[model samples]
Target: MNIIALEALTFGLGRLAAASRKHGCSLTLFTRDKTVYDYELSLLDEQNIKVVEIDTFDDHAVVEMIRNEKDVVALLSSTDTWSLHCLDVSKSLGLPAQNADAVRIARDKYQLRNRLYEAGLSSAKSQLVDPRKFDNESVIKDISYPCIVKDTAGTGSQNVWIAYDKEDLLQTLDKAAQEVLRGQIAIEPFFSGTLYSLETLSWKGETRVIALTSRITSQEPYFREEAFSSPVTINHSISAALEVWIDNVLKSIGYGNGFAHTEFMITDTGFEVIEINPRLGGVQIGEALCQSLDINIYEAWIEMALNKRPALMDVPLNIHKGIGQLIIYATETGEFSHIEGLDRLSAHPGSPRFYPTAYSGKSISTIVDQRASIGILLAEGETSEVALLNVFAARNKIRVVMKG
Candidate 1:
């Protein structure tokens, strides 16, 4: 069968496409630039597959090309525009769509929150207040303390702020009010506690929790996500509770068809829902977790997308002693400086070190949410603290020199 896989971000979709080819399937990749095309070409070449490029998703010609591709059985996407493009193109053709309407709800935080609220799902009680309608001070008072101000539809924590006080809240509000911030922001109570993310697969009217990953964030105020690892290296009871909640959550959204990555918080009061994304998380943690635990999630996704019932691997969820993922960050955005302890980083007490693409003195920007991950440091140990120490030791070694 021939498949069209959207290649917009480094979402490990390319690998999924390649796996399709390895299993005697052909894939047509959609790309807009030579840089992305060349990168995808190199990777696809390894699997002996050629890519067909669509320079723009906005063109009618592109849509026609997608509609007319011979034997085009499925189309997969992970771009911000994927929900819009895939829905338009897939419907034009006679292909499957995960959730055309749900895609919009999942992509837009405002709509997502409203939907979740309407469904009576556990979430931070939020309001979508347009500043032009009311005063910022009144909005702050209306919500719970330690609230988060976030862009309605943004990724990688680009414009997310956790307001601590009135002044900071006002500043953040004003900054969000600029010309680029036409959409509304979420003023929700900041639910405190341990945060966890769950990946659920919906197939054949039977939804199951594929993997539960625990995300570790930077020490608050900045709220940058550092890293995430699978099996949630936490209590079994906690994971089980999450499983039950996740299953119901998707079923509520009418998602017994495809993928959903939902974030949640386990607090002393109870478990509250964080936002859920319709696509896979960008860190490629699902594949990483599968590798660490002897499971192949990407291949399974491909198999199911092609109408073939792919059996889920029996990944021993809690068998992991201590698996940890570390997100590397530049001290400042500048030219490539020097890494301090390469020997120490390479010589982790646990497993392997996944050094990101950044090298000494490479020019980098000073914004680290998810995309700013210079590299990933992973190591499994007897204890999470040991794993954390091992990761920190490696991260501390990298000395970056940004352009001044």
Candidate 2:
């Protein structure tokens, strides 16, 4: 069987291939670059990274191409364009993108809200807008006050802003609009509460939640993720609302199969759906979960994509507690200069939770959208505070020198 991966996010392709091989299945990688593709092929050629040769996402032609192929399987996408083409073209071939209609919920936040509204679900009351008129005070009043704003397509949080008052709201409109390439955007009430993610796997019509973990983000106004952990280590009763919301959310989004990474807020108002990504949770959270629980979610994801649900997934929950991850965000942008404490941090007792993601010489971006421009410091621990401090400790130990 061929496993077609989308992008190499630090380590996506390797993890998928390792897991697939462990499950006794052969795999191939589909890369966007001919050179990098060939380069990886040279490295993992022994491990089965075959470059996916395709020109465009023409639905019919792709269907014909894969019709005679071996057990070929692909999953939901991450990179914007490739992800869409994967869904549009692959589902046309009875492959993974089964929840084709649900792709939009991930692509456009407004689409997510609309489907939630129709389903009588509670969420940040939001609506779509043209970037040109987004600053109009009238439009601000349209959503009421103290709302959040960001580009529709995805500035990756470039100009995303949270307005506590009308003035801040109007002031951010222009900057925020400029960040969106689509000139379209979304505005919603700023979420207030603890945020968490339920990175789960769903079979045909049935939802199987393996991890209900909490997420740490850049002190939001622009809520880009910084780190994540497996198993929130909380009782199901405490997260009962989340469990209900998850089941309803999958049904509402029309997701009958595949993996889903959902972001939500647990507030006094209840579990409010923030947004959902119909793919594996990044930061190797899924891999971490697999390590802690002895299950290969990535492999299970591949199986479902190929129209087969491996029986090993039913090997009982075995997961007794939740895990946590903390992402230490950078305060400045510059090439990483010197580093310290990774060895000591790694040596600390009770399983060290610190990891620095910056590689000296890479410039970082301080803006929320540019937050990732700085790279991440990862940590995992039993409690949120432990995890958070681990991330902080790692960040404190590292330094980056900007080329001035």
TM-score of 1: 0.85
Report lDDT (CA) for all predictions. 0.66, 0.62
Candidate with the greatest lDDT versus the true structure: 1
In model 2, which regions exceed 4 Å deviation?
A: 22-24, 33-45, 51-81, 91-96, 133-137, 155-159, 310-313, 320-324, 328-330, 336-341, 350-360, 365-367, 370-391
List candidate 1 stretches off by more than 4 Å. 8-14, 33-47, 56-61, 79-81, 131-141, 165-167, 179-183, 313-322, 336-346, 355-363, 382-389
Tens-place lDDT per residue, model 1, 1-404, is: 77777654454656676578666777776677534334335555544554666665664756787766777778777556455677777777768877767677777777776666677776545677664456856776766567888877777666677887777777777767772552467777788888888777677657667666777887777678887666555578876877777777776666667767888888898777767777666565655555555555677667777776656533344444445677767766556555455566555577656644454555566555654556566766565456555655656555544555
- Our model 2 lands, by Cα RMSD against the true structure, at 4.0
Residue 151 lDDT in candidate 2: 60
Taking the tens digit of each residue's C-alpha lDDT, what string does model 2 give over 1-404? Answer: 56555544443455567667775666654444444333334446464555566553454655565565587656435445455677766656666465567766666777777778778886445677676664465576656667877665553445467888767776776666555364367787776788888877778778777777667667756666666655666766876756667888889888867677777887887777777777666665765677567666566755665567845447675663334454544455554454444566565423544333444564565645434443444455555446555555555555544555
Q: After superposition, how far is residue 136 of candidate 1 from its true place, in Å?
A: 4.6
